[model samples]
Target: MKNNTHHKTIRSFVTIFVIFSSLLLFSAQQTHATPIDPQYIFVRKDGSSCNPSDCSQFWSFNNPDKINQAAIDDVLNKIGTRGNNNNTRKIGIGVLIHYNRHNLNNILASIDKLLPLATENQIPLFIVLDGFQYLNKAPELWNWWDQDQPGYDLKNRSNVEWTCSNGSSCATKTAWRNWASEISLAFPHPNLASPTFIQANKNKLNTMLPKISSWYQSLPQDKKWLLGGISLGLEVNIGGNYYHYSNGINPNAPNPGPGNSQSDQLGYAAIQFLGLEGGITSANLDKVVQNYYTELNKYAYQLGIPRQKIFDHVNSPGFTLPNHIITTPESSLSPYGNPAWSFYNGDAANPQQFDTLHTIFQQQGYIEWGAAEWRAPNTTYSSWYQAFQNNFNFGNTRFINISNWERIRSEPEILKAIKTIANEEPTCWVTKPQINITTDKKSVSFKINPGNNNQKTRLHISSSSEYRENGLLQNIDIVNVPLNPNSTYSKPNLSDGQYYWNIVTTGCTNQRRITAGTFKIASQSLPGDLNGDGSVNIFDYNILVAGFGTKYDIFDYNNLITNYGQ
Candidate 1:
């Protein structure tokens, strides 16, 4: 009986030991694990590829009853909301409301139908309030302004030509500023309009913004979060390459200049609109464009929308503006100091655009930014995969809206890329560590604080044999050294060079690699420079004498005596 009891106790101890060992192994694996694939909130614009006739019927502005529910559902289903792949990933639905005076009721009715579906499916609604889409569809909106300027129809054209009653040449600087200001203000707050301005003529047409804000406010508290964000305008820009004439322009159009193309017409119109006597330039154009978005974002903020939720779409590659320039597409349209939405359709293999964007973000200390629209240059699977991978590797890309849902859905490669992104775990920096020393005289000691407790953390140290190539650290030397938070890790024998360190924390769902920044070790230590103050002097001798017995030995004193001064 005694032998049997002893055997039972030994078995229990062995089992407990095995379980404890397994738990330790699991914890270690989680701490050092490579982050999973990135996941994104994939959004598709509704009725984007429909024919004009189909769109008119499907998105009926005059008659809400005529709006086809079945067609809308079919599109939504295919986007993976209520389809066969309902469990695939979170899909957002975008609704574009072409603002006009007579369509408020119709717009509301359409939203009423779509909002419930989005809410039911737990999908986000990307509401795009497009002011330009109605330019050709509702010519009457521009009739009051068109009366003074005949032959210059602001219809189906990307550029807006605002001429005075005295002709295109009569616009003064003050007049241009006033006109631009009034238009910019009126775009957001249509009711508060200057009676003298041309924008006032379409006051009723621009009321859609406030009306939509009210509609959004009136929703149940639970459903309000479903409204992803409201875009003030789509791809808002000052007449750049994007602002080409919808119907090809005649190269021989007179008055603006001789041998003028559509681009020249845009430049001329921009000059008149901005009152820039020096013609089209990035600085002048950026100011006007910035103000437009600033006012729009301001009004949206007043309506209780958070800064992060409001977006203005622009296609400009993110560039750091000069000091004199207060705003650009990158700065002004940024929801909160980071461009929330920009289009990317460049070659995936050579993603130099993102490189520039990454540098700007790093320099400005902005946390999150996203590609509002991204598409592969080609239909090949490799092209799509490379494009998605490039964006993913940059690490801050929070959103990527496929430009054309119909086209993307048809291509197996594009769909595969989307699926791959959806399945991947999103890697993000949680809290960057604050290092003790930025530059060391000789050896390096890193006192790292990851700034979070109760989380599994590890330290990653890397040295680049060659200095950074294209803003990326090369040749990683050390990685995944287990570390306790807020602890000191000293490399007392490191040679003179720049070294990078980061903290990797394993969270509940995602693994965060927090960059602790780079430190440089300059070998300026003399044999007797115990104080490490560049030159071996009385200070070095004092340090050596102070720690004679407890810290320093006879060798240290000998070194100090040998190279005391010269």
Candidate 2:
């Protein structure tokens, strides 16, 4: 949906671009934080975490059999006995929605794949459905059909046929709010489960999450289940623009649009083709589904979703519930976007005005998961963009193309880079530049202004001469400044350079430049004044004549600028 404007000043920290890139470069030499179990997040003590490419999903998977047993014992031990370990019971819950019989099997399969994650995390699940009434009731059985707008509320449709045998007639449709109370028993597929028999013609996840939130709250602290929004719910993050995520570089572009809600994200995450009734395939469908799971695991840490509860859902005795399947296109990118949630006045029906999905999902404790497209050049990675919005006052959701676990796998150098730059600190990182010798062949001497207020830090070092345009750099200069705990940045030496060298300092409270190597040098080299190249002879004169009165770029800097005075 379209959004207006809002702002927040989050304590900015080291942009992980360098760290992520480092992971890619040194995948071999770096100490990878392997998956502890399923998708657990690994933090390498701030600066200590040198490798990024090895960052698999969230927690690593360890043979499902072993994982399951461990989870069961852990759950029993924690539940039966108690100690200082207060917040260990959590689980990774996966929830998927289905409409009519179409794509029911795929939904089931998604849930099936979710078990290993659940076991590893140690949590139970509570999957709910808003529009997908038929599939949720049965939990196992499903019917299918081709194209037929079963209408918002499935009432009368061929494939969606219902049965009035077990409960009431097709006329008496049960609402989501009421159905939520009936726990422990799965509803059987009805005769007129189709559109005609449907009564509640409404499907708004925003109107549903709050209602379902109680189910999670009612459980014991340890048994509480976390929420997961599959395709539609997850896709909400991949908003309107495609960004190239590297070193937190803001790729300037036109506003693509605001993100979607959980249900809306799920729809957007889908891939479709308008072939004979939309050329959608199982792979496209699975691709969309997997995006949801992998992303859910990646950002699960931010969701406030308890870790242990998720484990129980996968490893628990009742873990083997029937699954929902998929066999359609609309499941991914929503061939037809849901009218319930959108950027256009937050109303899909209008398609004119817009509001960000964050306005909706952020209302509760739910945070959207940012997933990968498997294929490259994917424009919809949401987590980075969503977080970026907090940094820039642009729109509610700023589009950011950041790396995920998958990128971590592929990029080896990112880890190696971090290793080269980092020294371990158990709690947080202490990244400082290593300037060897400046272009002037002298030590770096610059201004000092620690960015953080009251956060004192040691200050030293000067800016070296700009890189030699004609020759390679000889020695680098780095002044070691012993910074205090919370100091901001130490200043860099200033010069007559026009580029201003972007004024980099040590101990920056904001941009920590953890894995960033090579400091920015002021390129104010005077044409004929080669710093120490002897005399302004043919060598220095040629340098000046080559680059005349140009300001900064005229790296013709040397020890011969006095010739003009002569």
Candidate 3:
């Protein structure tokens, strides 16, 4: 009996030991496993506030500068900004809508991205919204009508008729103006809720035109007004006004079309959240921004905003991918006869349009990315370079979506169009102003018409450190002088040896900076004997060692190592 009891006890101990060992192994694996990828952390996000009306969901930014910097830095390099941009210019943006509690968070996000561009462009944005919750939650964001008191009288000071200008059916305009007043009357001050009606959306918009003109009239004459907003606001701001404008989630809301973008519906949901009484989640806000960009080229063009402006938002090289631009040439499939086309999308309507847009996009030095399958809003391409002529035409001009076209294999003979354009830009790149870089340190020489000598010559040279990252040349050395026809750079100081210099030439009267390909300053010639100090010393031996040995540096490395020999 004692032996049997002892055997039972031993068995139970063994079983317990086995279970403990397995648990230990599992825990070890869990602790030592690979870390997860770092996802973007949007400060304003919290899982619970995914809905729009909750202001808590909205990303909080008390300082407008960070938002402004993100925006200005994104656009200035592409769309171009004018003189002396400390980024503190007042820009007016008119959005006509009152975001209910559900969409208020999204409303704030939309304006956040829009404000920097306005500020950078020197335009102050004046938003027209039927108020939900205002003040502290969204700083730098305001609703005139939502404020009550002076909202009505602010518009009348101008000479324009109450709702119509020069007598026309201004039903749309008048209706919105009336709505703003009604929404204002209901929500005179913040509380649990204000009344809801379709008229409120309409009324918030019509309030824009008259009030905007007055605000525009109020600004210092030099300032410009920019209009931004999504959906209902888009309708009133751009659709209703006939104002030449640029914005996202375009083509007016409720686009009843055969090709309804299911993807675009995300924007509607985002708007609904942002337009809510309080606010929406930050993730939702980001999605709204992304969706707007996703529909960009097609919708913007459809809305008649210029292509360059539409492309500007995508100019942020560091903004990550959707962003499928081929960042590294090694990632390119040049080894096979099927290199990915250096463009984005599936709309292949106009082959030339696809081709031209890519050309223009890349010319600005942006790396391009696209979906594996073209997800463009319009156009198509059948094969490489062979475009379907007139297959897609807007009025007289043709437009194509490269996304629909066949991929271009990087071949020796078919030299890609992008490469051709890249090499062709006359060294001087222009965004808002002109800038030229002389990569070579050797002396560069040139005249207005290289072959013709009659033009007055002016050369502006700046040290590399003098140029800002945006390529703006500051503190440059300017030399203005006339030369006889064919007078090679009146000064030959920029030689092959002493070529650590940058030279920019302009026609004295044209005010145009002439672009000479980046040239180098020639290495300063060593005068003395045939070699170092005219002597066959250790210096010469060191020079020989640097050039002949595998350990020697490529250029200056050997020269420096041998310059002063033992």
- For TM-score, the strongest prediction is 1
lDDT of 2 by residue, 1-566 (tens): 12221111111112222443454455423222221111111111111122454321222111112222332343223223211121211222223343332243443343344444443555443332323333443322221221242223332222221221211132122211111132211222222222222222122323333333444444332232233222223122111111112111222323221211111111111332111223233444334433332333223312332222111001101111122122222122211111111111112112122233333223311111112111122223343232222212211110111222233333434323222212211122122232222233122333332322223333333234222111111122444454443234333443433221222222223212111113333343443444432223333343444454564232333233335322
Candidate 2 local Cα displacement, residue 273, angstroms:
29
Evaluate all candidate structures by whole-model CA lDDT and list the values in order. 0.47, 0.26, 0.27
Least accurate 10 contiguous residues by lDDT in model 2: 311-320
- TM-score of candidate 1 to 2 decimals: 0.52
> For model 1, how does the per-residue alpha-carbon lDDT over 1-566 read when each residue is reduced to its tens digit?
99998677557545644654575566445434332112245545544245554353244445556544554464454443321132222345555666543456666676666655555665566676655423433443333333454333433121333322232342211111111121111111111111222243235324555555665666554344456566665555544323222222323333221111222223344445446556545665555555455555555655555444555566546423232122244433332222545554453333446555556555534334555555557677777666777765564444556665544544667666555555554344243343454233556555555532216666667884221211222445754467655676666666666676654444423323333345565555678776454566554555655686789865665576578674
Q: What local lDDT does model 2 show for residue 38?
A: 16
Superposed Cα deviation of residue 279, candidate 3 (Å): 13
Q: Count clashing residue pairs in model 3.
A: 78
**Judged by TM-score relative to the true structure, which candidate is superior, 2 or 3?**
2
Compute each candidate's TM-score over C-alphas: 0.52, 0.21, 0.21
What's the best-to-worst order under lDDT?
1, 3, 2
